[model samples]
Every structure is written in C-alpha cells, then in structure tokens.
Target: MKDKIRIGCGAGFSGDRLDPAVVLVKDGKLDYLVLECLAERTIALAQKRKLQNPAWGYDPLLERRIESLLELLLEQKVKLITNMGAANPLSAADKVIEIAKRKNLSVRVAAVVGDDVLAKLDVAALSLETKQPLSSHGKIVSANAYLGADGILEALKTNADIIITGRVADPSLFIAPMLHELGWAENDFDRMGKGTVLGHLLECAGQVTGGYYADPGKKHVPDMVNLGHPFVDVFADGSGLLGKVNGTGGVINLDTAKEQLLYEVVNPHAYYTPDVIADFTSVKLMQQAKDRVRVTGGSGTTKPDTLKVSVGYQAGYLGEGEITYAGGNAVGRAKLAGEIVRERLRHTFNEIKVDLMGLNAVHGNALHSTEPYEVRLRVAAKTPDAALAARVGEEVEALYTNGPGGGGGVRKYVHEMIGIVSCLMDRNLIKPEVIIKSI
Candidate 1:
C-alpha cells in the first residue's frame, strides 16, 4: 500500500531453526514480513515447558531465526510482524527487545494482548462449534483466544520495526497493513476479504508452493529442504504479489496453491473471519510457472459476529513398549500377554489405566481388526505420581511369568512413563475481541 509494499510469510517447525522466507523479503526490499510459529500442539508444549520452568516454556527457535532475519532487515531497514510467541507474546517480545538492545539495533517491540481470556473462561458462553465460552468448566489447561488484525495495525501506527504477538488470526497478520496504509475502515469488506484470502494462502509458506505437496507432473518441487516461506506485495486497493525466496527450495505452481487453499478450510466461499467472511472462489490463481503464482480477484463479504479460539489441555499420559515376535501364535500370545499384564496391574493397584494401542483398535479398526501373527502392546497409566506411570512400564514385562506359550518368552520391551492432562475450551470463548495497542 505504501507506494509498492512487499510482504513475505513463512511456516517452519520449531525443532529446527532457519527462516529463508524472511531473508528473501529483506533482500527484495519488502515492506513487511510475517511468520507463524504456533500449531495445535504448540500451546500444550508451551504450557508443559512453563509447568517445568515458568520463564523457559516459550520456544526460542523462532527468536533465533529472527536474529538472522533481523540482521538482514536492519541492513535493508524493513519492518516485520510475526506471531512466534508460543504462549506469551509479551514475555517473548521482552526477550527480543533485550537481544536487540545488546546489539544496539534500536528496534522497537510491541506485544498485542487482550485476546487471551483464560482467567475468565466460562463454558456457559461458548458455542461448542466456535469453541468460545457460553458455559463454565473448572479445569482448563490452556485457552488462547485469537486476536483480530486491528491490534497489529495499531502497532504499525507507532512505526515499530518489529511486532511480536501472542496469538492473532493467521489472516490478520497479512490484513493489518492493508487496513493501516490504505486508511480502510471497517466497512471495507471486499478489500478485507482479499487480504484475508491472501493471508491464508501465504500462511504456510512452502505448503502452497509445493513444499509438502508433490505433483507428478512437476519434478522441481520434490526435495524442498531449504524451503522458502510465502509473502504478498500489497497495493492500496487490496491486491498483491505472491512469491517465495529467490533461491529457496520450493515451487509455487497453481496446482500446489489450490491444494494449500483446501488444506483444513471447511467452506471456501464462506471462509469466516472476525473482520469479514472472505470469498475465495473469486480468487484467480495465474500459474506463473515454477515456484510462482499470481493471485487476484479475491473478494469479501460482511464480517462475522464471533471470533475463533484455540484450546489445549492434558489428554492423559500413555506409555508404550513393544517386544518382537517370530512364532505362529505371535499375535495371540501378544494379546494374552497384554491381558495378563493388565490383570496383574489392576490386582496390584486400583486406578492405573491401560490400553492396547498397536494391538487393538487404537491405531484403526481397518488396519488390523482380526489381529495379526505379530503385534505390539502399548500400555499407559495415569495416577498421582510418576511412580504409577512408571509402575505400568515395570510390571508389563512380568507377563512372561505365565510360561513361554502362556506368558513367558516375553522379551523386555523399552519402558516409557507419560503424564497427560485433559484440555478443552468453550466454543463461545474462542472468539477474541480485537484491541489495538501501541508502544
């Protein structure tokens, strides 16, 4: 919107650290760059880490990756927005500020909050389908309400170099600037829809460009290790550029882009958003050939009344240990051995929970309904202490005491102890209230 603004977006797992998407945006003289870090499991993992160590829960993988990207941004002087904060954006932003201060970069960091309504979570207000609060449930491991794009717009107004957010809607990241630069008001539904669609397409950088998808017709998209992220070059009227890193290892073919569009979205025409229900059917993807696609004609409709929420909690702990089998009744023996172990444990203790994962319908009824010649026993337990979780692991091998065919010949399997919690959120509470904050 600002003359010619270029934006880049990327998707990467936290286990490894490298973001080429942001790198390309900086090098290409883009105005904005965004990255997504939180996944379905990210919240639980963040909480688990917090439970272990309060100041140590959030993943620093993205922060480290930002270090490299920030260096380039500093060199080229480009601003970026990212929701890399796994659980707490304020804390995460503070840490990044410290890093910047040490290097004397003079980068301003602001965190967008008010979306997380965990303290006042009530299941009575939730819609179940929306996952917000309409009622009350006493136990909630994690509740993160999605903030809309306006807050990021407010942050950008302050002209900060970097915006670190806790949990904002994926589409909002790309839509914020369009609202800010163009002076677009709340009634600009059509432009808003276009921004939303653009955001969704670029949310998972490599996926749309054939990182995970491999078309038999295209041989260039297969080995995408150094995959680049996604970004859009936006105009004041609500259209932009869709491309990747110049030399990254991904493709942006039309087929792959369409596949990513269908990834997890329910209704393409009625794609709901807090700001507006963007209609992607109007979106025209012009295949620019290898690793490039031109997206246009995306339109929008009225904004929805509710917001989206992400809820997480402990689902109970499970431990699994498997022993090999090479006999005629290997499957039968494994089942019997599992039953014997369960009986012995229940007799010894009352509240230990056990389930046969590999041997039963745990995997899928279609995989092995009648049982196989050889199978694995996956056992688990939930109790007051780690000892109980470990006890199941210790006692399962004793099944061999029943005799070689009856229970013996039971080679010891690897032992595992698991601790799990149950997590659910009210559908009503999932909708977040968008509030813009500035430095």
Candidate 2:
C-alpha cells in the first residue's frame, strides 16, 4: 500500500460550481476526487424527478460534471466517488458511460445501489424526530439507508474510474478511499474514526477552506469570489494535513478547521455515521503552516448496529411571495402589507408566516426595533390544497393595487415541499451492490 493518499473535494452540494473541481483535477495531484452532492431533501427531490422521468433522477448537473471532468480524470488517473446518483445510480452510471463514449474516452464507472429501503422499511418504526410511527408521516416517496465504505471499497477493487452512489453517508465517500488506498481493515475502529474526521472536514468541499467561515471585517476571508476547495493528505494511520490549492483564495487556518469540526455535530463525543461513531472531541488540530493544519487523535468504537434511514414524504405545498417597499416608512408599509396577508390567510392556513425581510425575516420579533428605510414584505403559508397555496402569493401580488402603496418587485413562488425524517434500520437489511458500466 502507498504511504499516503491525497484526496480533494470538488463540489460540496448539488449545483456547486465546476471550476474549483477543474483546478483540483489539473493541479491538486489527488488520487481521488470526491463530489459530495447529496443531501436528505436533495435525494427526495430526485425521487420526485424520477417519478416524472425515468432517466432524470440523478444529479441534474451529473452530465455536465461528467463531461467536464471525465477527460481530465482519465488523464490524471484520479478516481471519482460521488453520491450524485441521488435516486438512480444505474441511470447515472449509464449517463457517465454515454458521456465517456461521446468524448472517445475509455473508462469504467461503478454505480453503488441497494440503498433504497422503502419496500423493506417498517412503517411501525418510530420516527427519530417526532417519536411517532413512520406510517403517520403520510406518503413516503423515498427511504434510503446510509451505506458505509464497504460498497465503495468493493467498487475500488474493480478499479472503476468513477463510483456513483445513492444516499450513502457524506463522510463515507471520502472514507472509502482511505480504506481502499491504505488497506485499512473494515473493523479498525480507530483508523475508521480518524478517516471519518478527515472525511467530515473535507465533505463540505470549501467550508474548511474558508468559504463558510467568511464574515466580512471580523472573520475576513480574502478573495471570497475565488474560494478554493480543500484536500487532505492522509497517512495509513489516519492522521493528515488539510490544505487548499496553492495560491488559492481561501485559508485553512485553525479557526476555520475548528468551526467545521463542530458543524452539525450534536455531540462531539459520539458523532454517528454508517462506518463508526467518530469521537471528534479527541481530535487535535494544529496549524502546521500558513494554510496547512495537521489533524490527528480521533478515535472510535464499534459502529452502530442500526443505520439511519432518511424518509422523505409529501409534506404539503409552500406558497411564498415577496414585495419590496422603499422610501419613508418602508418598514411600516412592509409590516402593514404582511399584516394584510396574514389577516387574509390566518383563518385559512394554519401555518402562516409573515416577515419584514430587512427587519425581522430571520430573527423575527427579536430584532423588530430596527427601522430600515427599505424593507421587503414576505408572506408564506403551508397548505394541503394547491389552490389555497396559490392564493397566498396572489394576495401578496394584489398588494400592488389593493393593500400597500409603493410595493414593487413582486416575486411569488409555489412548490410542493418534501418533509424528511429519520428512522433506524438493521444493518443486515441493507445490501449495497456495485454495478460497473464502461465505454
């Protein structure tokens, strides 16, 4: 096995930019490039898309990403692993193969499947969030179990240039490479935990690289427009140095690394994943250089016997409208506009929210003291009936002539909202398979 492997994150989520990935492929000298593009709701939306069209469930940008990077991936011999497959790995693999054929490049792509556990899901299981029966969540569109590194490691054994998966844990995409490249044992909890730390740090692509850490004048990230993605050089023991592309716009200092460490972590002592219950509390981060941080000291025990399954169901529909009011008493006008909408819809819709964008959209009444010269009135409501949902925006648009004066830039939107919840499933129930397609 090699002494160390270099892995870089290309895209953090669905619709992330492609230019940063191109830079990594050309100059990052990475053995693996992971594009973690799947989120809980993202997969649910993909399922909805699949219901509409059989061939369109995967990441919408999959074709463009494959077309853009397939040539460089082949030239650089950098293997790719991504959860961009979303709801359809088989179709995603086919798309990649088609892209390779069009470009006259010979490559083998692997699609990891079997994550969908909807048929096997027990509706009697309790929801981890609401503590209610899964059956009570309404119609479940998708139920996917979080697969670990096993499926990916199996794909690596085939030497596939790209491995696409559906609903695997975010960190598993990065951790699998470490297991395969370093020849780490599957049951090696300590090593797995360390690898998980590395994976979590790099999973968000640019978060640890200063993208999410930027706060003008306070946290002050330089050249925010051209922020670069991050890469880690991981040793067999799981310790690694995290950094970004040389001369890139982002910084990888201790402060940025620490923030990412605690991100979305409910408990640092028992951070759960498909592979292991990583203990981030034990992790040590030290600035080794200008933009390099040495990470080590992560450990863990055996992984959970049950895997988390994200259940997506038809939540209802969200109707939203925004109208901007400027000049004197703009906040007052916006507030009045919101009050009108709320008064009109309050009896019809149970979940109605009205906010003044520049004043109390985020903090609500907590920051109502600020009186801005210009403010946008936003009114939203959730309802089961699409017609009723449509009325919410209609009422806001009517404010142009009916309710408030000086109200302009009316924007309205209505869409079906997917609700996500989690339940635990036995590990033995999930059987991940790898299907390889080649041009």
Best-performing candidate as measured by lDDT: 2
- Candidate that scores best on TM-score: 2
Give the range of the ten consecutive residues with the poorest summed lDDT in model 2: 363-372
Residue by residue across 182-259, what tens digits does model 2's lDDT show?
Answer: 988899999999999999999999899898788877998888788889999999989999988887788999999999
* Candidate 1 per-residue lDDT over residues 32-141, each given as its tens digit: 77777766567656766667766655566856766677667767767778877667666677777767776776667767766666675554554454444433332356
Error (Å) of candidate 2 at residue 85 is: 0.8
Q: Which stretches of candidate 2 lie over 4 Å from their true place?
A: none
